[model samples]
Structure formats: structure tokens, C-alpha cells
Target chain A: MAMEAYQAQFAAHLPKAGPAWLADLRQAAAARFSAAGLPDRKVEEWRYTNLKPVQEQLFALDTAPVGDTPPALLQDSHRLVFSNGVLQGSADDLPDGVRLAGMAETMAENPGLLAGHMGKLAQGQELPLPALNQALSRDGYVLAIDPGISVSRPIEILFLSDGGASYPRNLILAGAGAQATVVEHYLGLGGGGYFINAVTEVEAAAGAKLQRYKIQQDASGSSHIATLAGQLQDGARLENFDLNLGGQLVRSEIHMALQGVGAEAALNGVYLLRGKQHCDNAIQMDHAVGATNSQQDYRGILDDHAHAVFQGKITVRPDAQGIEGHQLNKTLLLSDEAEIDSKPELQILADDVKCSHGATAGELDETGLFYLRSRGIPEDEARQLLMTAFISETLAKIDSDAVRGIMERLVGEWMAA
Target chain B: MLEIKGLHADVDGKEILKGIDLSIGEGEVHAIMGPNGSGKSTLSYVLSGRDGYDVTAGTITYRGRDLSELSIEERAAEGIFLGFQYPVELPGVSSTTFLKTALNAVRRQRGQDELDAVQFMKRLRVHTKALNISDDMLRRGVNVGFSGGEKKRNEILQMALLEPHFAVLDETDSGLDIDALKVVAEGVNALRGPKRSMLVITHYQRLLDYIVPDYVHVLAHGRIARSGGKELALELEEKGYGAFVSGTEAA
Candidate 1:
């Protein structure tokens, strides 16, 4: 089907009971997605990741699966489970100041909850994936935290798929001085073919802190595309860690704008790919104000015929002085056929600002391997140990020991498989 | 016991170890000292089955078995340990983790039960304390950002932990102060037993002074030019390696 046909089909499925404003917004977003169409190699940002695989398949909107509980991996989390783009049930074991609300239920109770902030942070729909998500998303959450309150518990959102296309949207707002940890788990059940378009918007007020963890372990026959956009206020901090270890094709585009002074953003990730999987991560960091800091550290382990791509862009405006930004992407290739393409870009228009970017792609270090082998470690075990050490360097930066442990264990299981 | 007959080796297609013959019996400590570019390190690498150090000729027999037939790790599992001159700095791999993995691997190959975390730690602490390796250093990455003395001590720590029957120390005293050298020598000395053997290769006789060898051989042009008792080390230290080099060239 053509782009317009898919948009028309998607528009036909828009819920008829929504308010007029939401219906109008959906129509506009549908038209925008149709106009933009699917991005191709000609698009510089999408050059390394071709969207032909997505274009070749036409999927209908999925119906909510019945009585699906949270996956075992998320049993301990205070979570809202979404099955096939429909909010199921929510549980709250969090602290007093934290609030987790399902968008569908919240919107039904109070129509004006999303009035000012629904599409405010994610205004730009120039990309087709985000535009498509905006047109068809029917289930997500509106998680908020009160000012001066710290929630020690983690808020998790599980998006489970059952072999069809689903669009999930999440909006997170942290009030002044509030802090919380959020985890987004995208999983595909039944080993079926599916397409997931996820869009998330985060707003951190002054002095607020937010740690976001995104884990993607979809089915091998699925395609996942997620768009993450956020803004930080003065003295705010954001730590976003992405773990990509599944799906046949995956692309995560992140855009973070530091609009306030003394704001900091740390974006780190690890991708373990094997078989014929392809994972691409594109990040854009905008330091629009002075005294803002940002760091991007991403590492990957690519094996077999898998391919990984990382393209990071950090821009400092002319007035944003005293900014410190560092971007790096390192990958370890485990097989002769595996491939990686990394590009770290830094654009600094302001003087007196420090910025650096680097990209390294290499095989295992021979000397390190020999050193381990000389101590009686077999070649295979020695190689795995060195590769794990390479990745542990980045995982060590994660402040939460529990989350880091889970991620490391997942990497270990992947290696063993 | 170890035996080498007409051993010839090359690195990067260039011959480094020419025809050489030597033998060491059980409980023997043999020292091979030579000047720079005399293939002291090459001989150690060949014995340990390192990659790219081609043995174009000759044979190395360990306990009546062909050492050349074993892979690097196989040779290590078979009780051949090489203490590197420059210990590899492995970031994110704690010293404790490395030692445990190495110990467990050798134990598994030898049909012995592997030690758990607590057992491994108890064994590690003994040697570490003897070598003056701090608890903080044991928790840190292996050889990462360690001082020169600390690196040498860590190598000896490995030697003590593994307790290989045939040990090869390649210039283990190259970058160490007097105090650190004494600690390292003490660690090596503690491991000496009737069933163990060692080949300590170095350029200077200073290390030999601390860990006296049963026999000392002067290696020149990839061949052992002279062999004698412990008194030969004192003789060479007084006259320097120039006498041996000239004598080997003249022969």
C-alpha cells in the first residue's frame, strides 16, 4: 500500500468517541505522516538504516489482547501494562508523591488533563514514525511527580505485542525538585511478526532529576521504532540508558534540549546484536543555554552477521558558554562478518566551550586475550571475558546497582545463547 | 623436567632463536641472562606457545611430552606459566576476578574441584599479603594504572596463586625498585619446592642475587653460549655481558 493508503486506513481506525480536539489533532497528524512518507537513504539521518523493510509490509491496527499480565521481568515494578495499544491494569507500590495514570482512563475522567502538554513537548512531527504514533496511539500513561518529593521505587511501562502493529505514547513530567526512575519495556510475545511505533516526551522542571531506562527485546521478526524527546529546566538532570538486544530491525532516535542553566544530561547505552539483527541509535543533544553539560557513551557487541550503527550530534549555540559535552561510541566486533558504522559529530558555535567526540570500532585485543590465555583460560572463555570487560566499563557508570545488574545479566544470557 | 634440542624460532619471519639446546631437571631454577636483542624474551615466548613466534626447527619436551603440540592455554593448563615482563592492563577486570578465573580453569583441566568465591579469596589473601598487595589493589582492575612495582608484584602474585610446575619469568625484574624487587623475590622464593621448576630470564644479575638460580646460562645470538653453577652469575656481574658476547662471537 502507498503512504496515503496506510494513513487513510489508520485514520479510519481512529476512535469515534474522543473529543473534537483530539480527533482534529489525529487527522492533522495522519496528514502529516502521509505527506512525509517513510524516510529513505536520501535522508541523511536515515542513511545507514533503510526503511524498505517497514514499507514492504502493511499492518492493521491491533486489538487489545485479553487478560495478559506483566512479563516476569517486570513483576517487581510499579507498572501499567499495555497489551496491543490498550491499557490493561495499573499497580502502585510507589511513594506518596509519585502518580502513575493511564492516559485513556485519565482522559475519560478529566478531559482537560492533557490540554496544555499532550503534544507540546513532541510538537515536531517531521519524522514519519513519530507522526504515525501521534495519529494512532490510544493507550499510554501520564506519570507525574510532585515537587520536593523523591520516589525511590521504579515506574515501569510494559508494551506487549501480539503479532500486529501498535502505537504507544508516554508523557512524563517531573515537577520542580522531584526525582524518579522510569523503565520502558517493549516486548513481543508469541514470536510473531509485529511493528511498534513508540513515542515518549519528558519534561523536567528546575532542580528535578529523572533516570530513564529503555529495554527492547521484541520478537526476532518484529520492527521497532521509537522517538524520545525531552527538555530540562535549570539545575535539572536527566540520565537515559538504552539497552537494545532484540528485534530484527530497531532504530531509536533521541533528542534532548537543555534550555536552562546548570542542566546536565547523560545518555548511555549498550547494544548486543547477533544473527541478522540490525540496531541503529541516533541522538541529538542541543545545549541551548550556558553552563549546561552532556555526555554520550555508547558501546556495542556485534556478532555473526549483525550490524550496528550509532550517529550522535551535539550542538552548542553561540550564547551557550561554559558548556562541557563529550560523545563517544565504541564497538567490539565478535565475528568476521559483523559490521558497525559510527559517527560522532560536535557543532559548537560558542567560544570558551569544551566539546569532543570520538568513534572506535575494533575486534578483541590480542594482547589482552593472550594475557588471559597464558593464565590457563581457554580461548573462547578469554574472548568473552575481555568483551564483557569492555562493556562493563560503560555499565559501571549506571548509578542504580539493581538496574545495572539486570542489564548485565541480560548481556550475559545473550552471550551464552 | 624440560628439554630443548636444536630449538629454532622466528618472529615476523625473522629468526630470533637459532639452534639452542638445554635441559632442566625437577626442582631446578635456571637463569638465562643476555643483553638487549639477544632473544631472551623470544625463548620464553616459544616455551609458552605464544602466537606468531614460529618454531621453525627443533623440539621442546616437557615430562616426555611434546610441548609444541599444546596450544597456549593447553600448555598453561599443563603447568606452564609465563610471567609477562609488561603485565597487561585489563580495565574492568578486577585482580580478584582474573585470579579466580585462571585458578578455576587450571583446576577444572587437572580434574580437581574448583574453589568457590570464599575459598579463592582465602588463598589469594595469603599470597597477596606476602607480596604486600593491598586489599584495595586486589579489588581494582588487573594491572590497570598500577605502578611499575605494583605490576611486578602482581605477576609474582599470579605465580604464587597458580603454582605451576614449570614457570618462566620473562624480565620480571625490569621495572622495579629495590623494595618492590625484594617483595617480588620473596614471593617467588616461597613457591620453590622439590616438584617445581622455573626459568627466570633477565638482562641483569641483580634479580639473580635475590633468587639464586641453581644454574645460569648466558644466551647469545639465540643460543646458550655458556652454562655453569651459581658462581657464574657473580662472575658475569663483575665482568658484564661484554665478555660472554665476545667469547660467543669468537667461537
Candidate 2:
């Protein structure tokens, strides 16, 4: 009865009019999500992170105005704000060669693009949360850059959650030889206990360079489940950076398919959690074609009773020879009660491939602490310095100076807190 | 500036510094020379308030304050510096940041305002230049990937910046070559003044020739078996530490 009640509520909010194809896709996704339900600890991919607390919450669709964006998320760039799955805020002024449109507007104006690329990279079938997101999401953005054009500035997307539940789907497509940077920042407003299920799909054409940064800082009471899936063509480069610094129940899955030769993927992230927070980061990098390179680095700092999970899997297919795949997950448990489950998986079916995965979980280096304390730094300050440095490895991989500086400051503030 | 009486310490439940007594006045530089396993490092660790070096029985009074009553950083705030024999490498903390933090912490503890970035940089430049340390070294992590001589020099640079009243240089010349030893000794000599005292711990007299100590004490079997002027270091070097290492002294 509870499931039926929730399903009826979701059905009431479905898009009234859309293309027949999209409607069918949404219906199929809803069926898939309803049949599977929430993933439990028994799921192999989500064995370490439990989602019962999130599933038990009765989250209705939210259609209210989210408050002003945080100053930290407001940088000098083309900004898009999506509040409660509704496109709002400033996106009027556009660059000369960049195109930005809401998913609904894009589908209505140019249905051919959506018909060709929508749901191609991320099908929402690999996991239940993404499927649920696909069924419930009402509005998102469609960003596309023209061929051979380089957008000099970053395009910032701010996702603000007001209350209840919101499902947002974003699609980024860079044409051949086009270069651009995009930032997806998630922020929670008011007393947040809502569930945010978001999915972002990206496609990079040949010789295109795309950098996407995702920052998830939800309210302590909120639950955030997000999936980022991208495909790279020949000679295409993709750099994805995710920073998880909030949310009580959070699981972020990033999947990339290197579909063509010379395609490169660099997926990196840093998660800092304290209190009873639980954050899980899963990365799947597939070298489907030959001569591809992929690097995955994720780090976590857990304090108090916080728990962190990092599962990074790199798969090199039979035709993916001459591939170089590297994945490393390092975690620092600040408190004795803190926990970490780091699983680095390497599936290699190809010959002449170089693949390595390493996972390390440990406390603060004692020698480093003593070195700092002996120089008159107090114990707490010393620990903070060490932890900051540990997280800096991931921060340093960020390509943008402004974003890196902001992230560094946020890390410092979190440490002091 | 520093006095120790009946100082007994243990490492992992094994006694190291046994009934050691020593004293150093203002402007004094005391050198404790001994061979391996003579408790030279244990004594330095005990004096610097390093954890796990339990002071089972003793009192270390520095400027009339009981050193045992202070934490490691508290002792550092009280103007006690210990130059580690094996300087630690802090991988991600730059040497410049380390020096600035240490200086500002000590200054703040002494009721002084923290130095701004410019002020700290200006002050650090003075010490780094005087210690023959390069600017590039300051930008790298503290002692990380540094040569043995560079590690020793960095330690002296910290000593110069902190300007402690009583410094214990535990084998400052252990890993240094001839030129590095000379440069490090010059840094120490420059810091010598009426308000400051130092304890130079070494096994050979090679270092004493450079930064000449005011008083030389031979530490054998965890106790001072001999005490004299700096010449005692040369005598022990000539005779070797055989007598001292055997738990019997020819003092």
C-alpha cells in the first residue's frame, strides 16, 4: 500500500505531454524501478552502502521556489539554476557559440537531438536509483557546443533542493573538436531531509575536450543519489571531478565508456564526512576500444562515526588492447570508530594492457603529526594540516584555478569544523 | 638554562637514560659524546618530551620550570628545541609553511601577535639565507626528498627561526659531509649569544672542531662518565668509544 501510494503520487506528477518515445521511455523506467525497488546491502555493487533509510522516507514531489544560490556557487560564468526540478534563475546572457536549453524546450524545439542522444550514454538500467530518477525527473538542461568552437568560460549549473523530492536529468554534448568546461553544483535549502535522485549524461565527440566538475553539499538530513555517465569518441578527452562534502546518506556513481581510440578519461574525487554521515562513491571506467587511457583517484576523510565507501572498477575489453588503466582510492579514518570500505576492481580481458588498482585506508601519519607538534603546532592543528594535505592530492588534480581555490577553502573550513 | 638530576628513562620498558645528571648555564654549549647504544638519543628524546620515552624517575628543570610538567608543544613553547638525529619528512607540508607555523605558534604562545604573510616571509628569508638554504627547498614539503645534509640544514634553519633559549642538537653532524658540516656549524655559531644555550650530542669530535662546545660530557651506559672542556671530545675520539660501549668507562 505504501509503494502504491508513492507510485500514485509519482504518476500524478508525470509530464502531461511529450514525444511518444520519451513517454514510453519514462514508462519503461518507472516499471523497472517499481519492479526492482531500492537496492539493499545484498546488491554486489552497493554491498557496503545501505539505502534503507532513504527508501523509508516518504518524499513527495516538490514544486516550490528554492532560495538564492550560495555565494560559493556563484562564479563569473554562464549559470543555470534548477530549483525543485524547475529551471529558474539567470541564463539569459549566453556566449557567442554556446547553446543552453532546458530538456523540455530542447525536446520541443529540436526533438531530433534528443531522439538521437537522449538516454544513450546513461540508460538507467544498471541501477534502480537512476531508473527512478529517469521516471520522476520533470525538467533538466541540454547543453551543446558547436563543432570546433571552444567556450573560454565555464558553464555553471546550480541544483537547489527546497523540500520533499527532486529528480533532475542533465545532458551535456560537445560536438567534434569542441572544448568546454561545465560545473554541476548541488545545494540544499532549509531543513533538508528530502531525497535527490539525479542523473547526468555526457557525450564527447572526436577531438573534443570536456571537463565536468560535480560538487555535492546537501543538508545533513538529506539523501543524495546521483549517477554520471559519459561516452568519449576517438581522440576525445574527459576529465570528471566530484567533491562530496555533505549529505547524511549519499551515493555517487560515475561511469565512463571509452568507446574510441585515443579516448582519455580522468575521474577523480575527494569525500570528507563527519558525524554519522555515510558517503559512497562508485566509479566504473570501461576501455571498450583500443589505445584508451583512464585514471581514477578517489580519497576520503572520515571522522567521528562516519563511514565511507569507495568502489572503483576499471574494465578493459578484448578489443581494448594498448589501454592504460590506473585506479587508486586512499582513505584516512580520523576517529577510531570511523569506517571505510575501499574496493578496487580491475577486469582485464585484453592482452598487452597495463592496469593497476590500489586501495589504502589508514589513520593520520604519526611521524607527520610528531614532526609538526615538535615544531610547536598543537595536536589538533597538526592533524588538520595532515588531513588537508592528504585531500590536496585530489584538489591539485582540478584544472580550474578558481574552483580549486574554492574547494581548498571549503576543505579547510570543514577541517576546522 | 637547563638542569637535569637523576633522570631515568625507559623505551619499551627497557631502561635507557639511567641516573643521568647534567647542567648548562646561559650562553653555554654542552656536548655529550658517546658511542652507539649509550642512551644519547634516549636522553634527547626524554628532554624534548617525546611520547613513549617514559621518565620513570627524574626531574628536568629548564629555566626553573619542571620540563616533565609540559607537553611536547608546550615545552617547545617554553623555548626548548630538539634537533632530531633523523629529521622526519612531512610529505605535503612545505618547509616555508612549517617554519611560518612554528614561528607564529611559538610567538603566539609568548603573547606576541601572529606575523602576517609578508612579515613571516621576510623573517623566514633572513634565517634561510643565513642557513644557506635555497628558496626552492622552502617551497617543497618539509624535509621530503631532501638529502641528508639538506635535512640537517633544514633542522638548523628551524632552530634559527624559533630561536630557542636551550637547544639540544642531537647528532647534527651525523649525516653531513665536510662542507655541509661547516655550513651547518656556521649557522649554529651565528645563533650563539648570551641569552641562548645549546647541547650538541655527537659520537666523534669531528663536529666539536666546528661549533666548539663550552662543556663536554661523556655519556656512557646512560650516565655521564666524564666531564671536561671541549678537549674531552678529542680524547674520546682518540681512544674510541670501546670503553664506554662495554658499560665500563675509563674516565
Candidate 3:
């Protein structure tokens, strides 16, 4: 399970079927990952989340077909099932101006399509996990929307982790004036110990808008680590929402580069964790141009010894002016043993900018509980009503009414169960 | 009917309510006037089964059942409602949700069918209109930014909606203006009937002027010092509680 052993073993088993450029790219990334091994507790980024639990697990990249065609989260949409990094079949439906293709099939059929795209965004990432993903990248999906074209149906990708370890590298390209919604759901089948290193890169052109929503419900013993790196152009917008419920350990990092004027980003998520589950949400919002705005709102509900970590940083560059970025994190500790550590950082080098950050962690309001109970509502129902009400504030921002209803129902089910 | 005999209660391990005996018929509206720290609020909380208002030596019988044997919500289901002086603010819960949930819960406890959304809204609209509560207020968070009189009116609205058999108004007129007090008192008056019993606790006579009580009791030093007709409230307002305090201590 040590890094050195896996490094050598992974290198020896590296597939030589790809082109020379891809091979070279993979080698360079592997070298970078080798130089800087997995971050430990001493590292500032990994301080709150202990990676020791994941490092102890041994994983092998063996593909075993589970043949899972699970029900779609949304009633009508495009669905794809990826089991152990292998796409089960081609994408469900196709509309004009939108292309959905698996990585392995695309590489085999049309190598030139991915020649200029793969490893382009992953190479620029700062985290070692992204580097590891680039080095061991396997089959995922690529969703490309044409310019000035808006898609009605959302693109849904169902990721099923059966056994062993897998690295899935995904990409989303939204052309100028394009608009779309993408959903990613990670689910584990059967109880087993595995590791998932996933990375998703998104590029939004000028005046484009894209919303990405994800739900992580892996098995209890699995460790799921994922990074979402997005770059926005002039007048572009990117909205990201994460609903983390399961998994023994989870680290979801959302990194955005606001490189153009009038670009905006909203990073919102919630972690409903219990039973020693640990989830860390790290966000890095870099405002490289003036007139760009961003906001981060995350809620945490920790119960039964669960621990959640939230670290958000908004940096306005020296020349950037008139940028407004704000972040707020609020947590409800339902049990005495539950814990939360929140750190909101604002590094403002710009002379004229508006940035504010705040965090709060507390238990349920006692007077509110008593008042509700005194009205004939049972004690448990009162708690559930209050907790769900607290979380629904952020989830209400979802643009689609159907998705919001589903999310609220899921949250209520979790509380009642 | 409700009965209390030798009721001794404590809050935070300190006895506040000494030996006391009181009785109320099903159709009577009684008022208790007292100075500060006279165990008035403690007695209301104890009757409603609030946590930490322990009854050390007492028997509170409501319809042949011991009040202490039930939980707070159980007491609510048994038709006991306490109108708080300061209504607790629920930041994310809307007034509509709170009212519907409370109504449905009480109905379920009473072995009756829960009202649907349409039925519940129709019932709530009747009370809100009489109390001058806006639809906007029902949509907003409960008591989040409500004015003082608005909060008191909201309590009265809830009392009418729940339709409790025994209602206790604890300092309901403390923060209301004269006009607001009239509105709230009218709302309370609407719900008064032959099957309902009311207990109004306050330190002023202005409220009793609007919703006149059948009987008035002056409390001092954790015991009822005097009992008389509704004229007792007017007398206490004129003379103040100095006489009642010194008289009870000397006795």
C-alpha cells in the first residue's frame, strides 16, 4: 500500500497502446506525482482530513463487469453507466449540437479528436491527485456543446464503482453562448474497500453558462476523492453543487479560474454525514480579471461522530478591481460527538474589491425545539423539520424545480431514516 | 375541568411555587395578577409539562389524568396551550408549515383525520383575517422580523387555530400597544366558548378591561393572597402590589 510500491507497479503495468504524445504526457505526470507523494497530515491542505485511512487500502485496476442499468435520477434525460471506468454502452440519446463520447471508444475510433484535448487541462492542475489521475487516466466521458446552442435535456452520467481502484478523467466544453446542465452521480455496488481518483475539467467560453451537480453515495468503506477544475472566459458563468452523503472518506476540491471580465461562479454544496464519515470541501476561487464575481455557500449536517471540513479561499489579483466575492459556511452539530472545522480565507490584493467570509458551527436551537414539541409535534419530527429547513435554504438555488424537489426529498429521507 | 392541590414546583432546583390550590370549571375565564418573581410563569410552564419546571409535591389533574405523566406534546394533545410572552423565532421554518404541522399533530393525537392542505389553509385564513395578519407574514420565517404586537397577535392566531380546551396566556399584553392589545383580546374572545377554560396571567388591568375575567386572584410570595370578582384586578391596579407582598409575608 505504500506509494513507492504502487508507483513502480503502476508504471510496469502502463498500457503502451496510446500514441507517443499521450505516453509522454502520462510519464511526465507520473514523475510529478512521484516527486510529490500523497499529502499527509502535516500538509496544510490535508490537515483537517486525514488521508491515512485511504493510504492503508490496497487497490488494483481490474475491470469486472457489474452490468448495472440503474434507474435515472431525473425522469427524462440522457444517461450513461460507467462501471469501473468502462462505459457499458454508447450514450442513450443524441441531440443536435451536442456530442457525448466515452474516452476509450473515442481514443480507439478517433484518436485525433482527443489528441489536442486530453491532458491539456489536467497538466495545469496544482494538486498531486489530479496529477495521479492524469497519469492513470482511464475511460470516462466527454460532453461538448456547440456555440449558441442550448440543450433542453440534461446530460447524466451514472458512475458505478464495483471493485478495485479506477481513475476517471472527464471533460466538459461549453462553447460561446452555450448553455447546459450536467449531473454526475457516484454510487458503489456491494460493500467493498476501493479507491476512486477522479478529475473533471470544464472550459466555458465567452457568454456561456454551465451548471454541474453531483451526488456522492459510495459504499461506507470506499474512499472517493475528486477534483473539479474549471476556467471561465469573459461573461461566462459556472455553478457547481455537491451533495455528499456516503463514503468513509471524501475530499472534493472545486478550483475555478475567473480569467475574464464579468465572469461569475457560484460554488454551493452540503454534506449530510454520520457514522464516522469524513468529508472535506476545499474551494479555490481565483479572480484574475476585474469585474468578476463569485460566491460560496456550503452547509454541513454532522451527526453520530461524523466530522466535516470546509476550507474556502478567494484571491483577487493585483490588477483586478471591482470584484465582489463572498463565502459563508454554517453547520449544525446534531450530536455531542460530531465535529466540524471551517476555515474561510480571503486574499485580496486588489485595491477596490468587496469580499467577506464568515463561518458558524452550533447545535440545534433548544427553544425552537421546545416550542415545536409543545405544539404536539413529536421530538424527532421537530428536529427533522428544523434541520431540513436549514439545508433547503442553499438547495433552493437550484434552477430546476424537479431537481430541487428530489434533493429535498432525499434529504428528508436521510433524516427520517 | 382542571384541579391543582398543594402544587409545589421548582425551576433549576429552587422551589418557586409553594403550596397552592386552584380550580377552574370548564366554562370559566380566570385571571391571575401578580408582581415579579411570584411563580406565575413557573406555574404555567409546570401545567404545560415544560422541561425543568419540576413539580416536587403536587397533583395536577386534567380530566381525571395526571398532567405530569405526559410529555409536552402529550399535554398539548390533551388540549393545553400556553401562549408564550416572547414567541421563539424559527429562522427557516415558515409560519404556514408550523401551523399546519401543529394542527395535524394534535388531530392525529386525538384520533381524528388530518386536514389536507386546502382544508388547513381555509382554516388558517379565517383566523389570520380576523387578527389582521397578512399573507406575507405567513410566508416569512416565524417571528423572524415580526414587530412586538405582531408577535402577540401571532400567538392569538395559533390559539384560535389549535382550539385548545384549556388555554394559558402568559403576559400576553406585556409588549403590545393599546390598539394591538384590543385586536389580540378580540381574537382571544372569539375562541372563548362553553367547552373552553382560560387562565390569563398578567401584571396589568388594561387587558382585563378588554377580555374581562370571571374571577381574579392576586398572587404574592408564591401563593394566592386574595380571590374576588373581576373587580379585584381594578383594585390591585389602583393600590399596587405593596399591600399584597407585605400582607402575605406577615401571614
Give lDDT tens digits, candidate 2, residues B55-128: 99988899999898899888888898999889998877878888888889988888899999999989888887
What docking class should model 2 receive? Answer: medium
**Over the stretch B1-251, how does candidate 3's per-residue lDDT look in tens digits?**
99999999989999899987899999799999898889888888898888899999979999889888999999999999999988999988999999999999999999999999999999999889999999989998888899999999999988898889999999999988899999999999999999999999998888999989999998877888899999998888887887778844321
Per-residue alpha-carbon lDDT of candidate 1 for residues A171-276, written as tens digits (9 for 90 to 100): 8889999998888888777776788888898999999999999989888888989989999999999999999988999999999999999999999999999999
Report the C-alpha lDDT of model 1 over B1-251, residue by residue, as the tens digit. 89999999999999999999999999999999888888999998899888999999999999999998899988888999999999999998888899999999999988899999999989988888788889889889999889999998899888888889999999989889888888888888989899999999988889999999999999998888899998998888888888989744321
Clashing pairs in 3: none
List each model's interface RMSD: 0.6, 1.0, 0.8
Model 2 clash pairs are none
**Over 4 Å off in model 3, which ranges?**
A1-4, A56-59, A115-117, A122-126, B247-251
Clash totals in order: 0, 0, 0
**Which should have the higher TM-score, number 1 or number 3?**
3
Q: Tell me the tens digit of each residue's lDDT in model 2 across A30-142.
A: 77776677877888998988888776553477568777756636467888888877788447677676788787677777877777677776775567777777777777888
What TM-score against the true fold does each predicted structure earn? 0.94, 0.95, 0.96
- Whole-structure CA lDDT of model 3: 0.87
